[model samples]
Target: MTLASSSKPSANRKPTSYESLMAGVAAGAIEGAITYPTEFVKTRAQFSADAGGKRGVMSILTDTIKTRGISGLYSGSGAMIAGNGLKAGVRFLTYDSIKELLRDSNGKMTPGRTVLAGLAAGVVEATIAVTPSETIKTKLIQDASSLQPQYTNMVNGTIGICRTEGVMGIYRGLWPTIMKQGANSAVRFTSYAWIQGLMINFTQPPSGKLSSTMTFGAGAMAGLITVYTTMPLDNIKTRMQSTGASLKYRNSLDCLTKIIREEGVQRLWGGTTPRLARLMMSGGIVFAVYERLIGVMTSL
Candidate 1:
C-alpha cells in the first residue's frame, strides 16, 4: 500500500499483506528467469575483456547464440530465479516491516528518512540471503573461455562450492556484493519509499488501498534509480566474482582500480543495456506482484 493509504487505514478497503509480498517474490523469480539471458550476456560483456568489452548488446546476444546457443544464455538461470526472488521477497518484507515499526514508534513516516529505512532493508537482504547467490551469479556469466575452477557449472556450480567450501565458500565475493548492494539499496529503497509517498499524495485514498498501477510505477522508479546509481560498482563486482577467488586483484577496492586502469573509466558502465532492462522489467513485476499477492491473500 502507498504511504498515503497507510496513513488512514480503514476496515473496508484494507490491502492484504500476504498478497503483496507473494506477488513481488513470484514476479521477481519469473522475470529473473526470463531475463537471465540478458543478465548472462551483460555479465560476460562486463567481465570478459576477450569478449570485447565494447560489444553492443545486440552483438553480445548474437555471439551468445552463435557460440553457446540458447541454453547458454541462461546458464545461471536457476540461481537467479531463487536468489532474485528471495531478494525481492525479503527486501519488500523488510522495507514495509521497518516502515511499520518506525511509524509505530514515531507516529508517522516522514519522507525525509525514507532512504534510511530502505537502506536498512537492503542491507538485511543483501547480507543475509542475497550475497552468496549474487557471487555465484557473477561467475555464471563469464565467457566459457574464461570460466574458472569454481564456476564450471555457472550458477549451479555453487552446489560444488558449498560441498567444498561449506556455506562460507559460497560467499567468497560477499564483501564486494555487500558493498555494491549496500549502495544500491540506499538508492533503491529510498526511491521506492519516496515514490510510493508521491503516488499516495497524488491518489489519496478513500481508504488504504492503492491502485495496482501506482505500485508498479513506484517500483520502476525505485529500480531505475538503483540500477543507474550503482551499475558501475555492479559491473566491477561481477568481474571480480567471476575471476578465480585465488587469482584476481585481492579485494573490491583493488578490483575497482584495476578495471579503471586497464579498461578505462567507461568500462564501469559496461553491460548497462541488459542491466537497465533487467531492473526496469523486474522492478515493475516485483512490486506489482508483491502488492497484488498481499491483496489477494488479504481477500482470502
Candidate 2:
C-alpha cells in the first residue's frame, strides 16, 4: 500500500522522525543484504586496474565464486549491512527533519526544498556513517581479492586499519563520499518524487495511494537516473577508499585525472553495470519497505 492509500486522513499523516529512522533502518538492512553480491562485484570492478579490458559483472561474479567460493561474494557484507542500516536511519531522520522545516504553510515541500533536504541528508549520512563503513567495506573486499587476505572479518579489519593507518584510515574517502552521496540522494529523492507524482496523477487510485508496483517502478527509474549521473563520483569514492589509495592517488581530483589519463574516459564508469543493478533494486526495495513500515507504524 502506498502512503496515500488510507481511508482516514490520519492514515496519510506524515511519519514522525523516529518512525522514519526505524523504517529506514529496516529498509536499508533488507536492501543491503539482498543486493550485496552486486555491491561486492561493483567495488571490485571499481578498484580494479584492468585498463587493457574491462571485466563484465558476470565475469567478476564467476571468477570470485570460482576462486574464493560463493561466500566470497559477501566478503564485506557485515560492514555493509550494519552501515547501510545506520546510514539509512540517519538519512531518513535528517531528510524528514529538513523536509518538515522546509514545508510551506500549507505543509507542502517544493521540489527545490525536497532536493535540498535530500542533499543535506546525504551529506550527514556520508559524514557520520557512510565514509567509515564504506572505507572498511572497500578494504575488506580488496583484502579478500588478494593472494593472502590480511583482515579476516569486519571487526578485525576495522581494528587492523586503525592500528596501522590510525583512525583516519577508516575515513579514507571523505570528500568524494560526501560529493557522491549528496548528489546521489538529491537526484534519487527528487526523481522518485517526480516520477511518483506523475504516476499518481495518471492512476488516481481510489485511496489516493499508489499501488506497490507503481511505487517500485518509480523508485527503480529514480535509481537508474542516479546511477548514470553519479557513477563517476562513485568510482572516485571507491578508488579513494581502497587499500593503498594514499600511495596510488593524492586526492579525488588526482584520482579522476589518473583514471582518465591512464585508463581512458570510459574507465570512470568501470562498475556501472553492477552498481546500476544494485541501485535500481536498492531504490525499489528501500522505498517500498520504508513506506510499508511507515504505514504500519503510523497506523499504530
Scored by TM-score, the top model is 2
Cα misplacement distance, residue 67 of candidate 1 (Å): 3.0
lDDT of 1 by residue, 75-184 (tens): 76777888887877777767777777666454667654566667776778778767778766665555353534335564347776677657776676676777777777
- For all predictions, the C-alpha RMSD in Å is 3.3, 2.3
Clashing pairs for model 2 are none
lDDT of 2 by residue, 1-300 (tens): 232211123345678888899999999999999999999999887766543556677888999999989899999899999999999999988988887788788766688888998899999999999999999999999899889999889999999999999999999999999999999999998888888777877886776666677778888999999999999999999988887779888889999998899998988888999899999999998888887788788777
lDDT of every predicted structure (CA atoms): 0.69, 0.86
Prediction 1 global C-alpha lDDT:
0.69
lDDT of 2 at 82: 95
Lowest summed lDDT window (length 10), candidate 2: 1-10
Ten residues in sequence with the least summed lDDT for candidate 1: 3-12
